[model samples]
Target: MDQTTSWGILAALAALIGGFLWEGGHWEGLIEKTALLIVFGGTFAAVAVSYPASRLRQIPESLKTVFRPAAPDVPARIDELVELATIARREGVLALENKIADHPDAFIRNGLQIVVDGTDPELSRQILEFEIDAVEQRMENQSKIFESAGGYAPTMGIIGTVMGLIHVLSNLADPGSLGPAIAVAFTATLYGVASANILYLPVASKIRIRAADSVQFMEMMLEGILAIQAGENPALVRKKLTAFMHTEEMSFARKKEESEDGTETEQTQTKRA
Candidate 1:
């Protein structure tokens, strides 16, 4: 699980509830189920109307993407690319046909297959680039689902509050119940605003961040695949892909290079010189 997101949500709720209790607010005052149904149900309905069910189905997977993000091993990817380049350069690109059929990443596997089939370099890059852009759009649209919910949540809350206030105003005979009724009505506003800020918007932001990282990782793969198709030197492939590495990836690359016995390829010779 993503500790940051989980802890962040917990801390926000703790501060809010703790502060409310500290201020002499009753715990029962915050548990307005009617208000919750209004905000959440209405917000969900609005979002369902806003996007087709086909897109809405992606919400569960998008949340999973945020919470259980795949940490791509950049250095490992570069190593694989370099190894593939070596084989393609030495044994000809077709030599990779029997190798990448079952490659882990669908992106890399499909890309290498295209190259093995002797697709033109320019056409290959276009095909891969198009795939990357399409993926980014799809991921971004998924985040927009939450963003739309966030946008609608507060309005739904307000509508609930208005409905509650309407009932409160109609039953003005009991002044004794006025205070509790008004407070209950306003819980809709609280639910709407709080859920938007603490949950929907935050989850949307997290999804976007994950999406960006996924696209960057795919771009790295794209570059590696293209370079391999071009018959670039394995050392050069490593050099090109290294620029895409984050700090932790750089550390991994250094460790892998250090463990080698100066005979893996020209990288050892390059390091020695």
Candidate 2:
């Protein structure tokens, strides 16, 4: 999976155990199942109660956000479209039919297919923009779900803590049981704080970043499609699309140039991240 996520979690757990060992010189099953059940179960139940079924179902994707790679750069994408445009100009848009299957980036492929099918430029732009908006909206919803869950987690933790305290107070006559009961009571709060900070919030941030990157990619494709429709020169279109590439994307182009002695610089890879 994602090494960052894996390593961060492993390191956190190792540090936690190491701290405990350093303090007490031994390890015990310090975690309490009942506390976890109350905190985690209650927080999840709260999310289910708060969000719609469709939104709740999208939570898994937010978790996957941690491991998912970022979207490919827009400049690199422009390069690919330039190649396709060159081919279409020399031959015809119909030649793209076979190339569509070989192409990467579903958005570009779909737009190319539309042009090849002779859709009017205005209608094609409208449809592509609509699809982009839909995808962006879905991603935003997923991010908001985690944000909402993060908002709810600490409250659930407090609830769990209070519930534990209630148990501890109930057993006031039994001094021998007070220590473990108090520790268990506070454990729920730890779960809530930890889950929200390390899990939900970070995932939501990643989703937002990915959504923005994807939007940029879509914007580039829109420009490429419109230029293609107007029968602009491929070199000109490449120049225009270059404006959309992030700084990091341009670095990939530099490496691509070095790999093939700049001759194959025109034939950039069509793959999208």
Candidate 3:
């Protein structure tokens, strides 16, 4: 599970709720079933109408992606690619064929298959690049689904508020109910804005980030495959792929270095003692 995404959502809700309570607002004021039904139900209906049935079918998977993002292990992939490059350099490109079955990622496997088949390098790169583009486009479309929901949610909330007002206006003879009715009407607006910012828009942004990371990882693999097919040295292959490591991976590398340094220092002191 993506703890950052999960904790971020919880923190946002806690801040909002805590601030409201601090301001002497009652929790009951935020609980309007009619407003919730209108904003959420209407937002869903709008999103369903906006996207195709096939796209709609992916909502569950999309939601899961936002909550449980699959981050690629960049260092591990680099090591694997360097190993493959070494194997190809020593034993020939055909050696990769045996390793392809053991590979987990289809992208890496396909790239290796092309190399093992003696496909022209330029054509292989084009095919792999095209696949990467298609995957990116598909992920972009999926993110847009949530983006569309974010766009529509606030408008739906306004519509719900308007509808509530109309009902309140129609029953204006009950002066005692005016305050509560107005509060209920405004709850729809709160729901719409909060859900859009907290859920839909954030999910879209997370998906986009994941898509970019995935593309970078695939590109690194493609580069490794091409390098191996061209018989690049394993050290050079490792050098090229390390460029794909993001800041987080760099930080991890730094921490690992520090740990090793500490271990070496402790061993030296122990030897002296």
TM-score of 3: 0.90
Give the TM-scores of the predictions, in the order they appear: 0.93, 0.82, 0.90
Estimate every model's Cα lDDT from 0 to 1.
0.90, 0.79, 0.90
**Model 1, range 18-123, lDDT digits (tens) per residue?**
9999999989989999998999999999999999999999988998888877778777778889999999999999999987767888999999999999999999
Supply the global lDDT for candidate 3: 0.90
- Candidate 1: regions farther than 4 A off: 258-273
Worst 10 residues of 1 by lDDT: 256-265
lDDT of 1 at 171: 100
| Candidate with the larger TM-score of 1 and 2 | 1
Instruction: Report backbone clashes per prediction.
Output: 0, 0, 0
Cα deviation at 226, candidate 2, in Å, is 2.0
Ranking 2 against 3 by lDDT, winner: 3
Candidate 3 stretches with Cα past 4 Å from truth are 251-273
Taking the tens digit of each residue's C-alpha lDDT, what string does model 2 give over 1-273? 668777876787687778877887454445778767877788788878888998888777766765766546555566678877888888878877887777867887888889889999899999999989998999999888888778888888888889999989987898998987888788888788878887777778878887887888888889998787677888678767867776777677556546644555545543321
